[model samples]
Target: MIDIVYILNQIDGVLYFPILIIVMAVAGLYFTLKTRGVQIRLFVESLRILFEPSGDESSVSSLQAMLVSTASRVGTGNIIGVSTAICLGGPGAVFWMWLMCIIGASSAFIESTLAQIFKRMDNDGNFYGGPAYYIEQGLKKPKIAALFCICLIATYALGFNLLCSYNLQSTFMDYSFYNPATTPMIIGAILAIITGYCLLGGGKRIIKVTNTIVPLMGVSYVIVSLIVILVNYYNIPAMFALIFQNAFDFQSIFAGFAGSCIVYGIKRGLFSNEAGVGSAPNASASATVSHPAKQGLVQTLSVYIDTLLLCTATALMCLSTGVARNAAVSGAPYVQSAIGSVFGTAGPIFITVAMVLFAFTTLLGNLYYVDNALIYLNRKNKPSKRFMNIFYVAAAFIVFIGAIIPMDAAWAMADITMGLMTLINLPACVSLGRIAVDCLKDYEKQKKEGKDPIFDATDIDIDTKMLDTWY
Candidate 1:
């Protein structure tokens, strides 16, 4: 298990920093320039359209789509993933993480816009599109499209579900009364039961559940962290200073983690926010909207919400309590320790309960994306609802199996699969980014004319008959 983790980390280290990080960073910069920094100029426009009703009666609203992606993005990554970054990379990692999200928002805008542009409607009248859809439609490479579908299912649906399930189990194991031998299986079974029920109900129930739970869970964590921060108000300035100082001088302050500060920081940041990772595009494509750029703008904001707000809150809450300095500390235990210091034993209790809800929601979001991937794989262009049902049950058992593994092994599997996914996905989003830029320009042009922006496939010179949603 240790060897597997080491090898995965080495591969991830190479791809993440020197390769995908640079690729995504350059793509982000290119898109930012092309779109004239739409993430900033249109930040308000993003929020404005969030509540606008999805004119299509069958599909979910834009806000619900955002929440669905957030449901996936805002899980253990915001809490456990942030804590791990701080522990492995030091407080300085926070700075790099925040930078990643801010820049990656542009990349998010690009990919999600492409998702909207290439979206297709099935015979059953449901909308579906993502990196896979765009890869086939724009790049005209069915093989690459199939490759991306396999990667998405492996990473987002299978890999993340297992990794997070292990963490959720680990949190429960921290207590004495829990049977170390049997407890993990028990937790896994319970999660499987709860999640299976929703999976059987189909996509809308999954979206409905996330929309209801994402806001409430996210706000609840923030409210508690705010209370913790308020009590440690004086330490806030010192914490901020430490973050900035160490970000640059981590080598002088912490002996071994010199270069790792930026690498681990960027890695965790990307993992947490998932801005350019192509995961959110699946959920972003699910929304019924007036224009593709509107969903793009909304998704751009989702990155900020994941890293800037939820992730920052977790970091401050951990660092402010002074628990994050311990190198051995990581994952939910770190966040739990920091909050426990302020709120008594309620810390573990709070996070354990929170993890159950947060991780469960993440699993549901994963299954939703998996459903889309399966659809994309269908050669017949017909509903694979029965096959999806079989996969869902198989995944529930996999979750139980994953819960039994050591946390290190779980993370190792997730990182390796996720690395391969980014390698395949970043190129598509980058090559096709110009489409997103043009879409944004068109939307702004219409808005300036005092008209509600509506996307017309014909206007873009793309094949109109291919895109059922736009027509």
Candidate 2:
């Protein structure tokens, strides 16, 4: 297992770079053009959904759905992840991060919209869909799509689920910043019990918890970052210069201008937000909205919030501090030290808190996604609920194991898995791209003509019966 993990890490480290850039750049450009710049058109409308009450009883409020994703999206990767990028890639990495978000927004919109288009109704009539559903429905390859779905469920539930608990426990124990011990059993037990209780209640319980955590953590992170930026206001121009200079000026730096910056920036950016990757679609598919395009719009806004808003703040904070560029510290410790330089011992403490909250939410969100995938795999109107519960409990144990082992290794494993999933999903999206656009255009026309933009399952261009069916 160790050797395999090491091998996977090496492959992931090399393969993921160019792939990230191509996907983000292409998907961003494609979606932007396809939707006729819906990102701009719905910019205000996206914000409006947050303020307005949800009328749909079956789907979560758009805000709640976003929060479910943000729960995972805003994790330690935003802070420590950003710090690591700038440290290795140089300050210029921030530019690529921002660039991806700008383009990745459209990619987010398209995939999520597709998820909505093929969303399945559970026995309870609740909406459930994601890569698996869309893959089966959109691609007409149930066996291939089922493989991806199982991979997703296994990756999340058996792999990352317990890894999160491990991260949380290690983070809390190491908050002292000196001595830390493995407490996997303790951590696993707590998470397992809590997750079991929540999973039994279904998606709403998971979303409810995520809704509360995501906003609180997001606001706090922003506030902390704002303080760091304000204190080092004078460094702002220099930081900006570093980012642009590194992004394109590779010949100028030790790492070369575009070389490391472009590589690491895109790598970290994709890791942080997962915009073009298919994971976000899982969360987006469940959103109850009158139009598939509405859910797409909502999820698109999330890409902005994750990378542009939350991630950019973390990057700026590290660059502004100057410590991130130092050769000495490295990785999460470097980020903690940078924050400490500004806020003293309290900075690390604050970061640990942020990481705990972010990672915790993300863990829950990912688990929720995996659970849905399992349902798709089982296909029967009535899945064996008990098996799903057992699988999640085991996942929590794995999360605990991942926490103390090594953050970088776990991240690498995650990157590899994520890349594989995206490879399958991106092509699927492009093949079904016209259908997504058609759905969007149809929805828009309906709204303009003073009609509700509801889609009958029968109207889906994709053949539902041809795809994988559980029952």
Candidate 3:
């Protein structure tokens, strides 16, 4: 009768506290220095390339790829996750979240740039890659690559998707019509059926669905947040002051650093933006950009959009209302109540709708990464139609199971799996950091020459034999 969830939580605590945080911070700083702050220097360039055409109608465009990744990054974590951080760690957590995004964007650039550099083109002329691709191709370690793929599948397809489903369903707990016993199953079934339909259609369908829904939902959510913020305009300045003051409270930092604002902020920030967690690169590699660094830069922009824009909107909307931050008012309920206080009954309704949209798109985006990892694990042999059908059914079944699980268990599972992914990806990125830096230099060198940058594998010192698409 060992409590597995408790053990998972304990392990997650140990992995994240000093170990993952230190490693992630160091990797982010290292990449920032190596690339001379590509995330900042190429900020405008990132926006410029985002709308660049794919050159082929069938290929994924840079904007499409970004939406795919952003779909996953801006899910329940943006709402429920932000609320939880502030509830437990105080408003100061918001400051740490922003700080993490600034540094973590560099790590995002390196991993995504490396993904594009070592990407593989399938027989159908589609591109695919991620940490597993670079780990095997760049580091020349098949075993490690396999390990990373397994972790990626577990994190996204199983753990995170489950949490998304649970969080989405939890939003309904405040409704009068919701029956605790039957409602979860009903909601889960509906979600699973919709998700299965998209998954069965394959990656293109998922891409199309996310590409359309992500933008609409993102803009709508932000508009609502803005309305809430403007309604409480008078409290905005004090909210900012509280966030900064708590962010730098040295006494709290030294007294109980483990439970301090910094830990929760960084943890929630990583979950929200997924900067260095190695997830976004799967989407980054899908884009048909002229230079690998172009897609890299776009993914860096995605990190900013997720944390700086979406997460900030949620944080400000919740805090500016002066909602009570306590264990009793954390997660989805906290968000619903925070917005509810402002808009009355309409507030909770809007939050529920927003959560459904965010979490649904997140489910699709997370599974898209799972598809890429499966491709890598299958050794580039496209999974047979029969196998894919079975896979889709299994994925849908997991969504259903996620709905009935306890919230704490679901979050714990996701955090542990995601932490493992970061641990595996960051080290590999550090080891292969040189290639990404060289690619950036080559890109900048071309930009300075007044030439549109196009990547040539031979332009750098990496083994061209490993680059399937960039030859």
Candidate 4:
């Protein structure tokens, strides 16, 4: 019997190992150089712009948009994903994850800036855009844009959401009363019901939920990680040494590049921060900023927050506890075990609660992107209210289905779909990247003149006729 799930994993591995990694690295480096390290040079500026008011109650603020994106970025990937990386790829994977964030932030800025540059507005005074809008408007390729939108819908609505559901349910396996079959179905029903309520209420409801949950959950998780670090202060120095030592083992890296620490770190890091993968731009395009670069910079900071802060917090909590790292304890169990080493019975309970919050917010956040993609696909003849309601019910059923699937199968499905999305998005970003670069220059020139930067599409050579929001 040929196991289909095993084939999926193998295919995902081949897709990512050298080809995806090389393209992602080159694209990140290209953006980093083109913007002259915008991620670092404008770090403080990004922070300043993050809290700026939207100036319209109907429009999302920079902070709210960031929270919405962060809700998706900082999900189970920050918890179970990090644990899985360390377990399979060694502690050194943490170092590579950090490295990817630094490079990938620049890509995040470029894609998001382009998203805002070409965003669209509906009659209801709401904003929506992503790779699809930018590709069609900027690249003048509506067909490719449609393809990208289809991939986006599949990646977020079906693939990633399912993985999140599975990861959330996996946390309960340690409890004494857990039944592998019944517990997953029960938890899935509860999660699906809650998610369906939010989805049917539409985009505003989704934003409200993520905005409230992201900040509270992030702060609480960071505080808990701090406690874990303090308890294992004695082992901190050794942990750093181990991470670096394993990170730079060239011989091991060459021998098994696909299964190496670098590969796993990059894979999970991209999953967590989602910088170059092109997901954040959906939320970035929603913000009502005076300048596109402002939201771009804000999104760059979001990458740091997701990976550098939240993901690192998870990695350190696990490593600092000196927990055993191997396939047998990967995913949620590994994180639970690591924390349990420090807090005993209370640790697993805390992780379960955290997973619920993280995965739930992620589910909503992912659906938010799905809404954007659906709108783009249906721009010709807008989807009916009844159609959207049916879609919501169908989406909830997918969540239930996700909870019952095998873990490897769920993750492989997400990885392959996400990889496809990245392949489509990266090229479009590179082609339209010059516009983003020009936007940054315009922004900086205004800053130098001691004035607030406001975008004028005419300032750049791009066709402004298609930029509905800018006018």
Candidate 5:
């Protein structure tokens, strides 16, 4: 497993060092300009739509879909991942992470808006679309779409959920409440059962669970962070100063942590908000909206919530408590120590409970992508619900097994696969982004006229047939 992880990391270095970095950065910059800075311009309006109800009862609400994606985005990455970033890269990583999310929001807008524009009806009479659907249908590249979906499955299904389960198991086992030996299996089974409950109940059931759990977890985390921040209010300015000053310390002054800061921070940031990784669009596409850009804006807001709100909270907790200064910071321990500084033993327990809530919901959310991916992968023979049930059970079992064992190798593999998916999706977004641009223009035109914007497929010159709902 260690050998495999080593190999995967090597692969990741080759792919990302020059290629993925340039594409992701340049495309993010391109779209931010191409779209007239929609994320910034529409920030207020986007928030309003976020709280607004899903207009059609038949389709998932925009907020529910956003939460589903947020469920995945705001996971252990925000907590343990932040700890690792700071430990490895120094406080400056937080600044780079924030930068990634800000620019990546534009990338998210392009993919999600395209997903909405190209969404089609499944045989089950449910809405489904994503990077694969849009790449094949909108970009007219079936072979690339097929390749992309396979990587998506590898990244999310075979890799991420399993890692989430393993980490969840470890988080539970770390505490006094659960016996270390038996706790992992017990937690894994419990996760499987709960996940099966959502999966068997179908998409709406998944939506219901995410809509309920994700917000509660997010709000609770924010409240906890606020308490911690206020407790250490005097340290706030200096902590931020460390962040900004070290952010560009590419010299001997920062010593060992110089270049590492940017690398880890950007890596963790990409892992956290996942704005351009193409997963958010899967959730965004499920929404039934008058205009495709509505969901795009909602997803863009997710980037801000994930990084600016959640990740920053985690960083603040670590930095303010001085826990981040540890030379070998890793995983839940760093966060637990930070919380412990302010709240004592309650910190670890709070984090343990939060991990279960955040990671388990993420497990469910990752499954949603595979569920939609299965639909795109199996167009000829529409999957019966029974088949999907079997698939879900297998998925749960895989997570269970991964949880019961070590998952570091699988985690590394997932990083590589997820990176590939992002690279593939970014190019597609760059190409098909014009559709989103057109949709944005149409939506803005309607808004300026004092009208509730509604999307017409023809407005973007996309075949109405590709967008089954728009007619």
Candidate 6:
């Protein structure tokens, strides 16, 4: 197992340098150009949509959808992920991360728009959508769509749930100085119970829980980061210079640890916001909104908050205290060190609370991802509740085992799975680009003519029958 993980890590190191970086960044760049800065133009309108009370109470509120997206986005990537990027990529990696977020906003807009456009309502009148639905319904390719759903479920079940739960559990254990041997079992049991309850309640329940949690956690962490930044205000300039120098200075990257740093930074950034990896659209699809473009606008703003706001805050906090520059800086310890510099012994305690919340949100989000994919695979709610129970138990078991593995090994597996998921979705976005553009155009024309830009299921040619069943 260790050897396999080592090999995967080596592969990730080699591939992310140019491959993942170029693919994600270029996709974002292309989408941004294609949309002509639609992300920025629609930002305020999306916020309005998010805050307004929804007419349909059975479906998820817009705020709930945003939180679900946030639940997934604001995990390990904000804390350890940022520290890792800065440590390996130097300070400049943050700039690249920011660039990806900027361009990634467009990618989020396009993908989520497509998801909303092609979503299917199950027999139970609940909505479901993702890469699978878009590929099958919009592209007229069910075989490919089914394959995508299968891969996605595997990624969530076999990859994310285990890693996230383990990380959450470990961070807690570390904070309490508990015995590592016994903690995994306790963590696994608690996660199993919590996730089991949420999954049984369906997507609506997940969204409800996430909406309440994401904002509370996000605001608390941001406030804490602000305090750290103010305390270390003097170190901010040097941190910025180091980041800029390492990112553009090709010479620095080639100098032994420099290249690793660049690769690490970009990898974590991609992992953090999940720009083009296509996961956010799964949550975006279930929203009971008028036009696909509306949800798309909402999703683009989500990427900004995740990468630009949350992830950047974590990066600056670490850099300002020189946590990443030290050889001893690693794991959650790096973040604790940065915060501890200001708060003394209380720093690690704050981070422990933050990480637990972060990991908990991520675990809940991952379970939802798996549940939606299962719905797509089954296409009906009456399939087999028993089967889902088995899947959850198995996932919990894996989480226990995963907590015991070395951090690097666990993280490598996650990257490989995430990268593969991104590769599958990017092409679909490019091919279905016109459909998204048409939806946006139609929406704009209606808005201009003093009409609501609501997308009528009958008007669009796809399959109204599939969508009507949802409402």
TM-score: which candidate is best?
4
Model 1: per-residue lDDT, tens digit, 348-413? 898887887788778877777777777778872646678767887888877877788877678767
By lDDT, the candidates rank as 4, 3, 1, 5, 6, 2
lDDT tens digits, residue span 1-471, model 5 = 367556766786666666766787899899999998999989999999887777677779889888778878989788877877787667898998988888889999999898888887676666678899888887789989988888888878877877777777766544666776788888888887777666777556655665676678778888898888889999999999989988877783346532377767877788788878999888888887778999999999889988999999999988887764654446677788888888898888889888877887777768778766776778735588788878878887877776776544645655677888998899999888888998999999999999999887766676765555776
When 2 and 4 are scored with TM-score, the better candidate is 4
lDDT of candidates 1 onward, in order: 0.81, 0.71, 0.88, 0.90, 0.80, 0.75
Name the best candidate (by lDDT): 4
What TM-score, computed on C-alpha atoms, does each candidate reach?
Answer: 0.92, 0.86, 0.95, 0.95, 0.89, 0.89
Q: What is the Cα root-mean-square deviation between model 6 and the actual structure?
A: 3.4
Q: List the residue pairs that clash in candidate 1.
A: none
Give per-candidate clash totals. Answer: 0, 13, 0, 0, 1, 6
Q: Give the winner by lDDT: 1 or 4.
A: 4
Cα lDDT tens digits for candidate 3, 328-360: 777888888888887899999988878887887
Model 1's number of clashes is: 0
| Decoy 1 TM-score against native | 0.92
Q: Which of 2 and 5 is ahead in lDDT?
A: 5
- Evaluated at residue 339, the lDDT of candidate 2 is 74
Compose the digit string of candidate 4's lDDT tens values, residues 181-255.
Answer: 699999999989888887888457665765676678779889989899899999999999999999999899889
Q: Which is better, 2 or 3, measured by lDDT?
A: 3
Better of 2 and 4 by lDDT: 4
lDDT of 4 at 337: 89
